[model samples]
Target chain A: MSSITSSKKHPLFWVLLLIITVVTLFPIYWISVTSLKSPVEVISSRPTMLPQAPTLENYVSVVKSGFFRNMFNSLLVAVSATLLSLTLSTLASYALVRHNFPYRGNSLFLVWVLVVKILPPVVLAIPLYSVFIKMGLLNSRLGLIFVYQVYTLPYCIWMIFGFLKALPETFEEAAMIDGAGRFYILTRIVLPLARTGIIATSIFSVIAAWDEFLFALLFIRTPSLQTLPLVIVNYIGEYETLWGELMGIGLLTTLPVLFFSSYVYKYYTQGFSVSLK
Target chain B: MTQNKYQKSCFFYLILLPAVLVMLWLTIYPVLNVFTLSFFKYNYLSDEKVFVGLGNYIKLLKENLFMEAFRNTLVFSVLATAGEVILGIALALLFYGHFRGKKSFMIIAIFPMMVSSMVICAVWKTLYHYDIGLINFLLRETGAQPVGWLIDQSKALFSVVIIDVWQWTPFAFIMMQAAMGSIPEEIFEAAQIDGASYMKTVFSITMPILSDQIMLLIMLRTIDTFKLFGKVYALTQGGPGNSTETLSYYIYREGFSYFNLGKASTASIFVLLVVAGISFIYIGKILKKD
Candidate 1:
C-alpha cells in the first residue's frame, strides 16, 4: 500500500523495472536475431546490433535436413502425454474432491503422489533404461509417451487437487439433485468450470515432454525417431560448431510453448514445479 | 441398488487401475530394480547378469568419481540454494512495496522461470564463453583479467550455480511475497510503534514469521539443484576433469555413456536415498501442518 503511495513520486522503480525487463528479454531477443543473421554477422566481434538483411538460411537448413520431423515427433509425444495425464488426473481429482468414501484419507495419498514427483528422475534412469531395452520399447513413440506421462501425471494430479480444493462441492451436489449421474455431472458441469485449470496443467505436461532432453537422448537411438532437443544437442557436432543453427532450432523448438504459455502463464496453475524447482 | 453401488465402486477402481499400475511399473518397479541391480555386477550389452551380492555397492563406496560427485553435489546444492533463497527474498522485498511498474516487473521476473532449461543453458553458455563472451568482455573493460568460467575445474560448479540463480530466483521471490502478504499490517505497525527500525521490524517481526516459508523454499531448491543435469550438460558436459560432475550427471554418464548398468543402478539408489530423506523432512512437515 505504501508502495502505491511512493511509486507516484519515485521513478526509480520504473527505471529498475525497465532495466530488468530489458535484461530478462535480451538473451531471447539476441537468440532470435542471431538465428536470422548470416554466419559472418553472427560471429563478428562487433555487435550485429540489427540484422542488415535478415535471412531464413538457418531456418531452411534446420528444416530441409529433416529437423522438423524430429520436432513433430516431440510434438506428438508431448501431446499424447499431456492428453493422457490430463484425463487420468481429472478423474482422480474429481473422485477425491467430490466423494468421501469410507476410506477417504486422500490427502495422505496425495502426498504420496507428491513424493513420487520429488523422487529424482536420475534414480529411475538406469533401471528404466534396462526395462525399456528388454521390452523392446526403446526408440518407440508409444513407449516415450508412457514414460513422459508417468513423469508428470503426479504433477497433473497435484495441480488438479489444488484447483479442486477451492471449488465448492455444492455445484456437483446441485447436478446430482437435478438427477444427473456422477460421471455425467463430472463431464458436463465440473470439468467445464475447471477448464482453465486443466489447460494450465496440460501446458505444463506438454512443455515437460517437449523440453525434456536426458530421457529423449538416452532412450532414442534411431536418427528417424530423435526429438528436437536431441537434434539441437547433436547438431553441435564433435568438431566445428554451428551456433547460428543451434539458436535457430532452439527458437523453433520452444516457440509453441512460448506462445502458449505467454497467453496462459498468468493462470493460477503454477504447481510443484515452480514450488519444487 | 446395493449391487449397483458395488458395481460403480468397482468401475471407479478400474478407471484408477491403469494409472496406478503404470505408476507402479514406471516408478515403483524401477526403484525396486535399482536396489536389485545394485547387488549384481551386470552389463547391458554382454548379456551376463551375475549376482555378486553387494559387490557393485562396495566398489562404488571406494570409487573416487562417486566420492567427488557426492561431495560436489552437497556443496553445489547448499551454496546455490542459500544464494537463490536470499537473493529471491531480496528481489521479493525490493518488489514487495509495489511501484508504478509492478505488473511489468512481475512478468519479467517470471519470464526466466518459465523458459526451458536447455534454452537458458544455451544462452548462458554463450555469455560464459571466455573468448568473445559478454561476461569476459565486461570484465576486460573494467581492467580485470578474463577468467575461464566453465573450463576452470575449481570454478565450473560455481559457474553453473550462477546460471541456476539467474533462472530460479524468481521462484523464491514469488513464494516469499505470498508469505509476506499474509502478515497483518497492524502487527508491523505495532512493532514500529515499539521503536523498531525498518531492519528491526523486518528481522524481528517479519522474518521470524517468514521462517517456515523460507524453509520450504530451501528444501525445494536444494532437491531441484541436486538433480542438475541440463546446466552441466550444456555448460561443461561434466568436463575439465569432472570438476562439475554431480551425482545426477554421474548417473547419466554411468548409465548412458558407459552403459555400466550395475554401477549406475548403485549410484541411483544413493540419489534415491538422499532425495527421499529431503522429501521426508519437508513433506512430512507440510503434511503434519495440515
Candidate 2:
C-alpha cells in the first residue's frame, strides 16, 4: 500500500502503463473495427482507423446460413459435456471425501484424469474415431459432448474436491443423524453448500467447450453440426478480400463468453487462480 | 436396518464403479488402443489388421517430415512458453503500482485470451493478411515492405508463435498477478530499503519469490501448447508446403483425413511420450511436496 501510494506520484509510470495497455489491446480493437468496415474499406490498401461505413452484411450472411446451427451445435455439446462432467465429477469427488473405501490409495486414480489433459488429442483421435464409429456417435453432437467430458472432467473433480475439503463435515453428519439418506444429503446439503464452486466449475467448462476446436473439427462434419469456431474459419480466406466480416464473426463468437465471465468473473476466473496455485 | 461398516464401504465403491469404468474406457482404453495400433499397419477401410512389429516407428525415424515436426514442436513450444511467461511477468509488473485504469486495462489485455482460440485466430488471420493487414500497413508508413506474415514458408511458424503469445500471455499474467498479490508487500519493502533498484528488486527479490508459480505456469502452458491444434488448423493447414506441420496436426491428418491409423497411432505415442515425460516431473514434485 505504501509503495503504491509513493509510486503513483510519478507521471512517467502512468504514461508507460498506458502505452503497454494499448499495445496489449490493439489487436482485439483492430479486429472489432475490421468486422464493422465495409468490403471496400477493409480491402483498401490503406487502413482506416474508422470504417468507411459499418455494415452487418457479414453477420447477416453467417446468421442466414448454418451459423446459428453451428452455435446450436456448440451449445448442445458444451451444455451436455458440462452437465455430464459436473454430475460425474461431483459424485466421484463426494465419494472420495465422505467415504472410506477399499483401494483408497488409488484415491489417486482421480489424479490420473489429469493424464487425459496431457495426452494429445491427436493420439486420442485415431482410436476414439473407431470407438465412436462402432458406437455410431461420429458426427453426432453427443460424440463431441462425450469427448469434451474427457477434457473437463478432471478439472471438475479436482476443483469440486477442493471445495468439499474446505466445507465443514458437521453439516453432513447432522443430516445423517436426522435419518437422511446419503442421496438426499448429497442433493440437498452438499450440492447446495458447494454452489459457488459448482457454478465456477460450470462457467469454466462452458468456455472450454465453446472454444474447443480440434475434436469438433474431427468429430462433427455436417454443416449443421459444426461448432461456431469451425464455421467462422470456413468464411475466411488464405489470400483474401474482406477482413471486416471475419472480424465481426470473431467478435460475435467471443462476446457472450466475455459477458458471462464479467457477470460471474469473480467466481469463475478466481476459482481458476485458486486451483492453479 | 443395521448395515455393517464394510457393507457401507462397499456401497461407496459401487457408487464409484460406473464413473471409473467410463473414464477407463474413454481415456485409458483409447490410449492403450493407440499403443496397439502403433505396431500394426491397419488400412483405413480394411477388416484385416496386420501386425508389423515396429515398422511404423522405423518409418517415422527415417522420414524427414517427422523430424521437421519434432523440431518445429520443440521450437514453437519453447519460444511460445517463454514468451507468455516473460510477457506475463512484465504485464504483472506494470500493474504492481496502483493506477486508476489498471482493472480495465487488465480486462482488455486478457480479452484475446477469454475468446475462443478459433475466433481469435480468425481475427489474427486477417490482421496477418500480407496485402491488407494492419501490421503491414504500419510497416509501410515507415517505408518498409510488407512482411510475410503467414503465407511464406519461413515466417509461417513465426506467425503461429506470435498468435500463441497473444492468446496465452494473459494466462501467465493472471497466474503471476495472483502470486504477486500474495507476496507480503512488507517483504518487497524490505528489499527496497536494502538499496535495491527497481530492476534489481524484481530480478532478485520478485522473480526468485515467484519462481514456483512461474514454473507452474510453464507446465500448464506446455501441456496446452502441446495440444496446439486450433491455431495451426485455423492458420497454416500445415502449409506453404507443410512448413508449419506440427505433431498434433500431423496425427490429425493421418487419423481423420487420411484414416491412416497406424502412423497416426505412432505419432500419438510420440506425443504421449513427450507429454507424459514432462508430467512425470510435475507429478513427482506435487507428491513430494505433499
Candidate 3:
C-alpha cells in the first residue's frame, strides 16, 4: 500500500505516463502536421514527423472548397438541437421528478428514451426519411434539428433526470408555501441549483449533434446544406484522397469540441458520472 | 382548492407533453413505419411497392453479406469493448493516486474520444495507408516489411478495431477512474495493515468492489460499439470483400445506396430487436436500483 502510494515518485511511472500520453495525442499531432504540409509533401513516400516546410495552402484550399459553409451548417444544426432538446428535457424531467404520473408512466417514458438512445440511428433513419420527404423537410436545417432530438433529447432527459433527482425537494416546497408558483419555482430555484448539470448536458448535446453523420448524409441532399462531417468525408474519394485538405478540415471539425471539453473539463467528467449513475 | 390541485397536476402533464409528442413522432412512429415497410418489396426510385410478407427477412437470413455483417458487428463490438475496458482498468490502476500534472494529463488523454469519429478515422486512415503511412514508415525503419493495413481482407477488421480501441479506451478509463475514486481509502489501508500484497489487495478488495461499475461500463461500451458505423464508413466502407461490413452500414446501403427500402427496413428491425433486448437488461438493472 505504501509502495503503491509512492509509485508516482518513481521514474518508471513518469516514463510510462508520458508514453501513454503521446500515443493518445499522436493522431491530433499528426493531423495538425499533415494539414500544414503542402500537397506535394503530403504524398511523399517517406512521411515527415515534422512538416519540412510548413504552409497553410491546405487550409486555404479547404476554405475555397466551401468548408466554412459546411461549418456554419454544422454550427446552426448543433446549436439549435442543443437549445431545443435542453428546453424540452428540462421541463419534462422536472415534471417527472416532482410530480408522479399514473401507471409508472415516468419510468416507462425513461425506459423508452433509453431504448431510443441505444438503438442505432440507422433503424430510425429509414422511416424518418420517408416521413421527412413527405413533409418537405429534406435538405433543410430544421429537419436535421428535429431528427437530432433522437440523439440529444434522450440524453438530455437522462442527464437532467439524474441532476434533478439529486436536488432536495425542500426548496421547492418552501417556495410553494410562500405562494411561489410551480413555473416560477422551477425557473428560479431548481434551474439555478441544477446549473452545472444543465451546462454539462448542453455541452454533450452540441457534441453529439455536431458529430452526427448518418442522418445528415441521408436527409440533406443539397451540397450547400451539407454539414461539416459530410464535407470532411467528401475529401476521401475512391480514386484520389486529398490528404492535406482532409486533414485540414478534420482539424477544424475537432477544434470546437476540444475547446468545449477542455474548458469545463471538470463538469465534462461529472456529466459522465451522472449519466452512468 | 380542489380545482387548484387539479390545475397543478395538469401543469406537470403540460410540461411533459412536448417531449412525449416528439419522441412518439420520431421513435415510435418511425419504428412502426419500418415494421410496415418491412412487409413490402419497395424501391423508392421506382415508386413501386409490393407486399412481400416476410420475404425480405427470409432473404436477409440466407444472404451471405447480411450474415457476414452481423458477425462482423458482433466481433467488432466484443473485441473493441473488451480491449477498451481491459486497457482502461490498467490505466486506472496506474494513475490511481494523486500526481502532479494529473489534470492536464487526463484532459489530453481523453482528447481522442472528444474529437469527432470522422476526424479520428481520417487520421487513422492516413496512418493505416500502405505506402506512405507513418506506421509502415516506422516498420520500414525497423527493417520490417510494410503490411497492407486497410487493403488486406484478413487484417482490415482488426485495423478498424485498433482505431476504435485507440479512440475510445480513454472513455473506459474515465469511467473506471471515477468508480475507483468512489471506493473508500480505508479499505485499501485495512488490506495493507493485514499484510496483503499490492496485487492481492487489488484483486481481492478493489476488483470485487468495482464489479458493479465494471459491469455497467462494459454494457455501456457494448451498446455503443454495436452501433459501429462512423469508423467503418470512414475507414473501410465495408471494403476488401466485406471484411468490415457492419449492421448499420448494411442497413445504410440497402436503404439509401440501393434504394431497397423493404430489405433495409427488415435489417433495421433486426438491429432494433437486438439493441432493444440489450438495453432492456440495462434498464431493468438501473430501474431496479431506483
Candidate 4:
C-alpha cells in the first residue's frame, strides 16, 4: 500500500535491532560462560570473555551438595501443585461457565479468586507456618504442594474459566439433547477443547510454584526439604561468593523453565490477550 | 429433565466445593488471622499475645525503618513499572514489522523473564561486585571510574529497579506485541497510504488500539513489583542500610527474622491494603472496559 517508506529501510533500524538482541542475551551468555569457567579463572582480576579453562568442577560440587535433591524437591512441589490446581480448577471452571449458582454469578467467583491470587505470599507465610506446624506439615514437600494452591488454584480457575467462556454452548447443548450428562459432556467435549488453555495453566502454575521463595524459606526449615531456589539462596548465605557454582546451578535451574515457556509461548501470549478480552 | 434444580445446584457446588474450601481456608482464614494478629502485640518467640488494639499499627507507622521501606517500595514500583511498560512498548514498536531473526529474538528477549529472580540477581550481583566484576572491568577499560552499583546506598534502589526492568520488560513486550499483532496489517497499510509518517502512525493508530493491553500490563507489573522480596533477599537483603527495604522484605524481617508477629501482621495489613487499593482501581477499569 505504501512505496515511499518501504523502499528505503534505514540502517539505524538494523543497528537498534542488533543492540537490542545483544543487550537481551548478554547476561545469559555471561552467566553461561561464568558457570563453565575454572575456579582460577572465576575470581581472576581480569574478566574473561570466554572461559580460560572450562571445567565441570562447579556443577560437580553443586550436585554433590544436595543440589539434585533440591531440584527433585522443587519438581515434586511444582508438579503436584500444578496437577492439583488443574484438576480442581478444571471442574470448577466448567461448572462456572456452564451452570448458574444460587447466590452469586460466576464472574464474581472469578473476581474473588483473582483477589486471593494477588495477595502477597509473605502475608500468608506466618499464619500458614503456624497452621502447618500444628498439622505436622512443616518441612514437608506435601505441605508446600498443598499451600502453593493459594497461587496455582486461583490462576487455573481464572485462566481456564476464560477459555471455557469462549467455547460455543451449541455443542454442549447438542450433547445434552442426546441424554449425555454434565460430567460426560465436560470430559468428552469441554476438556478436549480447552486443552490449550489447560496446558497454558499448567505451565503458569509450575512456574509460580517453582519460582516461589518466600514461602519455601519460611515453611521448610529442614535443609533436606529445601527446593532449588532455597538451595541457590543457601549458596549465598552459607558460603563465600562461589559465583561459579552459583551460576552453574542457576543455569541448570533455569533451563527447564526456559524450555517449557518457549514451548507454551504462543498459548501464554494468547491467554493474556484472552484475559484482557 | 425430571431432576430438580436443587440437585443440579448441588452437583455444581459439589464439583466446586473442594477448590472453594481449599481457597477459603488458605486465603480467607489466613487473611483474617493476619488481620486479628495486627491488633495484638503478639510475639511468637515469647508466646505473648497481649491485645494492643492498633498499637502495632501505631508502632509500625512511627518506625523509621517501616516508613523507609514503604517509601522505597513506592519509588521502586513506580520507577520499575513505568520503565518496564514504556520500554516494553518501545521494543514492541521497534519490532513491529517482519524482520530477520525476529522469532529467535523474541524468545531470547523473554529468556530473562522465564528465569528465576534469584538467579538473575545472582548473575547481576556478580556483575555489580565492587572489584573484579565485569561492569567495573568495562568501566576501567573506558578510563571511567567504576561505579558502586550495589554498595552505594543511593544507587542501590535504582540498580534493583534496572534489574526489574531488564527481567520484566519482555513480559510487557510480549503482551503488547501480541495485542499489536492482532490488528490487521491492512490498518497500518491504510495509514501509510494516507501519507502518515511512522511516528504519526504509532501515536495515532498503533498505541490507541493497544491501550487495553497496556493497562493490563501496567496493573500486573505494578502489583508484582510492589511485592518485591526475592531480589532483595538474594541481592541486597534490604541493603547496606535501610536503602533497599521494601514492604514485603520489611514484613519478612518482622515475622520470620525477628518473630515479632504483631508488627509483621500490621505491616502485612498495610501492604495488603495498598495492594488491594491499587488492584481495586485496575479491576474497576477492567469492569468499565468490559
What residue pairs clash in candidate 2, if any at all? A34-A244, A35-A244
lDDT of 4 by residue, B133-156 (tens): 899999999999999999899999
Against the true structure, candidate 3 reaches a TM-score of: 0.97
The best candidate by lDDT is 3
Determine which window of 10 residues in candidate 4 chain A has minimal summed lDDT.
Answer: A1-10
Candidate 1 lDDT tens digits, B85-187: 9987876666665455565566656667777777777767767778766678778878999889988998988988887887777777777766776677778
Candidate with maximal DockQ = 3
**What is candidate 1's local distance difference test score?**
0.76
User: Which structure is stronger by lDDT: 2 or 4?
Assistant: 4
- lDDT-best of 1 and 4: 4
lDDT value for model 3: 0.88
* Cα RMSD for candidates in order: 3.0, 2.4, 1.7, 2.1
Interface RMSD of each: 3.3, 2.9, 2.1, 3.0
Each predicted model: what fraction of the native A–B Cα contacts (within 8 Å) does it retain?
A: 0.39, 0.61, 0.71, 0.56
Sort the candidates on DockQ, descending order. 3, 2, 4, 1
Instruction: List model 1 lDDT by residue over A167-238, tens digit each.
Output: 777887787778787678778888888887787778777878887877887788888898887776675534
- Worst-scoring 10-residue span by lDDT in model 1 chain B: B96-105
Instruction: Tell me which residue pairs clash in candidate 1.
Output: none
> What TM-score should be assigned to candidate 1?
0.91
